[model samples]
Target: MESFLVLAVLTSAARAQEVEWRHDYTFARREALDKNRPLIIDFTTENCFWCNKLETTTFRDSAVLSLLNDKFIPLKVSAQLNPQLTEALRIQSFPTLVLAAPDGKILSTLEGYLEAPKLAGHLQRTLTAVTNPDWMVRDVEEANKAITAGDQARAMGLLKSVLEDNQERPIQVQARHLLKDLEKQAADRLAQARQLEDKGQNAQALQALTKLLKTFPGTQAATEGGQLLTTLALKPEVKQEQRTRRAQELLTQARADYQNQQFLCCMDHCEVLAANYGDLPEGAEAAKLVEEIKSNPEWMRKACESLSERLALLYLCLAENLLKKGQPHEAALYLERVIQAFPSTPQAEVAQVRLSQIQGQPTQQTDFKKAAEKEEGPAVP
Candidate 1:
């Protein structure tokens, strides 16, 4: 029984260390590039208890370890020993996990310790994104083809789908550009109604606006026309059209708020539209927009978070490069800036650790400030 128990312990230890982590980031990068796979950088420190917990617990989980071993070029980076590499990677905290494309563009980052299940999910998503690379070019080409075929509706639908699904900033900008062109085309189609309204042809303008709304339902021009109908309805002679116009105006405003990234404001407008104009065409669009916003509440937040991480990484990289050139003071200044500007972020934690190391202080002695106070407890074992 004693021999069996010792054998079991040895076997478990071997299983726990199953993930073949590359010690060198450069080698891992090279392997990832060659294989066209994502580079998974696991940033850790000698004194980080959480990092040990991650290795012993989450990383020991068979599913999590198997996925990392199979799908990713995993690199184990020591934050203490590899200061320059750590800074370059912008490892803000111990146990900061980064998933990057073969070209070293960071796809996603998870700070702090995650349980096996959550980490597995993140790994799966990253693997899917890396392996099944979805390019905006395909959607762009499809939209262009639809436009050439004179299928404006089909083209608009494709563009909208791009906006909804594509997270790449460049692709989003391109989609927006295409949408602007489509919006202009739509505006031209409704020019007659606007002209009639400008000429004080109230009945004719109303007729034209109604026709535009019917012909181009669920469009930007239709939305604008709906709002204008509300404005016209407010006139003493057009009071009879007031009821539906108010709802249309609310729905239009809700959509505008959503596009502007004012998510909370959009929700408020959507609620009003739903309560008052649920039966109207604009209301239907509003309902869809509300559902989309609710379903993907983190879309804008994730974008902002990704941008912040990139900016922090930029500063850290610059600082590291400067330090390598024998400019400790300048490096310290950049680290200080990171701590000051992005307190509570992973970058801030890294800065704190690095700064402490430079000052001959304890690595665990971090003067980190929280972005928001929360119930504090050990995040890992």
Candidate 2:
């Protein structure tokens, strides 16, 4: 009788390890919140072989099943059934796993297939993050205080510090949102200063820029404001003529570079001119040139076929150009090509970083050229 009882207990325990995924996301989210666990939403479509493979193989693993049962409130969301949720989350591929906090803020999104061990590892890491949400909450609180006090720099610093750390997905998302808000605030202030400068209110514009730099140091707006300040200091008529002449010179150079087949160099000149003088005729011409170069199939084919570091650099430039044009999907394809073709090169690492950023993954701010240089080590002959 005792031996029979032991066998029954073992069977029950084994059965208990099996994962039970909730079909309803609402219920799963409520349960996750009540249990203080992360919610794992597995997004799959009808025609995805990899999604089926993941369900059959990875999700069926004893360890993965156990982790899902014990640590997460798992929900299986069919793209067909949950079209709104899929669109809201921007689910682009099959077998995407989104780990979100109880309050419905996404913590991380893992795309594609993973073996049992890797999936288990990811679950464990997410569990750690879910269990330790206090640090992130504290950081957000402090950042809010800094912002309320009109200390933009301190707020930005605090938010960036949280982003730099390995925090939960919601924390990183919140940080990114706040950073974008801060950037917009800085931009608005810069715009106000520019308006003042354009109206020949140089002294007021200078004052505004000085205040803006103090509030939003280390931002793109501050850099632009600083450069604008120099131009503002000059007589308005002279500044206008100088700007026109400079824009023309840049456009001429960019055209020359493009004709000479220096695509990357041409892009640089055109981008600068377009950004700084987009209101001018020269600026419009520069922007047109950039578009022409970017859309050139022959130029792109040559860049892709080039040897060594140049190929990676060309790919990177193309990706950046596409991103600036608000075409992230197209940019990602080029980035993937760079990674696949030059896996061992420094450019590959930078490409990966940029790809992650485009995918809404947590990534640190990185300079592409600087990252490549660091990875390449000492210059080669």
Best by lDDT: 2
Q: State the RMSD for candidate 1.
A: 31.9
Report, for every candidate in turn, its global Cα lDDT versus the true structure.
Answer: 0.79, 0.84
Tell me, what's the RMSD of every candidate?
31.9, 25.6
Q: What is the alpha-carbon lDDT for the whole of candidate 2?
A: 0.84
TM-score of each: 0.38, 0.46
Off by over 4 Å in 1: 1-17, 23-36, 88-90, 101-107, 128-141, 148-152, 162-381
How far does residue 292 in candidate 1 sit from its true spot (Å)?
A: 65
| Clash tally for model 2 | 1
Q: Clashes in candidate 1: how many?
A: 2
The alpha-carbon deviation from the true structure for residue 361 of candidate 1, after best TM-score superposition, in angstroms, is: 99
The sequence of per-residue lDDT tens digits that candidate 2 reaches over residues 10-115 is: 9998677656789997788899888878889999999899999998899889899988888789999999989999999999999999988777778789999989
Candidate number with greatest TM-score:
2
